[model samples]
Target: MSSEKIIQKIGQLYHQKLLMLVKDVSLVLVVVVAIVESVVRLLVVVVVVVVVVVVVVVVVVVVVVVVYSSSSKVVVVVVVVVVVVVVVVVVVVVVVI
Candidate 1:
């Protein structure tokens, strides 16, 4: 074969290989991005859930203390009710979303 033709063939092969490598790398990057996105979404959900639980508990405690600070029995009943309501709300929220 002529040297010019052989050189052209080698150039074509190199171009094809380069294209294949780019496609492979792009596929890997897409998968990695999808996984990272999923993890970030989950972390965001967890943080939101934690914040919500903390806020609810704090509010309930404050309300209970302010309203029934002198009655131990009433305080206990209110606390138990608050706990059950919090649990139910959390479960419903989680399930709905």
Candidate 2:
């Protein structure tokens, strides 16, 4: 073959190789993008679950605190009533005797 034809053949082969490289690179990029998207979605789901758990725990704590405080108030009221009755009884007994 002539030198010009040999050079043209080399040029054609180089072009084909470049196209193949571009195709492979684009495929790799697509795969990487898909993997990243999946990881982001998974992270979103995990965050949602964690938030729900935290909210449930907070609500339970608040309920326990309210019940404990109310019961303690009831106990205080009972003690006060008993002390007043004892005082009134002692006063009457001392006056009569």
Candidate 3:
């Protein structure tokens, strides 16, 4: 056989041997990676949920924490109402994402 063809045959045979040796290991690696990816995705979802809940709770606490002046009662009411509504909308959007 020509040198080039002989080299090509050797490469093919070497590849076959390498594949036979690593097939099982390659499968295991794929499975492990998939599981790790799934776990990471779950953790991300959980973190997002926790953050949204904390934001809502903090906003609610702010309404209780601030002592408003009587003159600015209407403004305070409007601000507080606006903040709460914004928070709710943000939570919804974040959760959907």
Candidate 4:
């Protein structure tokens, strides 16, 4: 083969190699982008779940506090009624004697 023919073949081979390299680089970039997007989506879901749990816990706490306060008020009213009844009975017995 002549030198001119050999040079032309070498140039063609280099061009093909360059094209293959560009395709490989593009594939790598696409895979990296997909992985990053998936991680970000997962993080967002976790944050949303945490926020919902916190809100539910706060609502439950408020309800419990209100119930406890109402029960305490009922106990106080019962105690006052019992004391008044005892005092009235003692006064009636003294008046009869």
Lowest lDDT 10-mer window, candidate 1?
88-97
Per residue, candidate 4 scores C-alpha lDDT tens digits across 33-79 of 99999997787667656655655565565556656776777656655
> Which one is best on TM-score?
2
Question: Residue-wise lDDT of candidate 3 within 61-92, one digit each (tens)?
Answer: 65654544355776577578767766876776
Candidate 3: 10-residue stretch with minimal lDDT? 62-71
What's the number of clashes in each of the models? 0, 0, 0, 0
Quote each prediction's TM-score.
Answer: 0.68, 0.69, 0.51, 0.58
Rank by lDDT (best first): 1, 3, 2, 4
When sorted by TM-score, best at the front, the candidate numbers are 2, 1, 4, 3
Give the Å shift of residue 68 in candidate 3.
6.7
Quickly count the clashes in candidate 1. 0
lDDT of all predictions, in order shown?
0.81, 0.71, 0.76, 0.70
Model 2 lDDT tens row, 8-57: 99999999999999999999999999999999778766765665565556
Model 3, CA-based lDDT: 0.76
Which stretches of candidate 2 lie above 4 Å from their native place? Answer: 70-97
lDDT value, residue 15 of candidate 4:
96
Question: Model 1 scores what on Cα lDDT?
Answer: 0.81
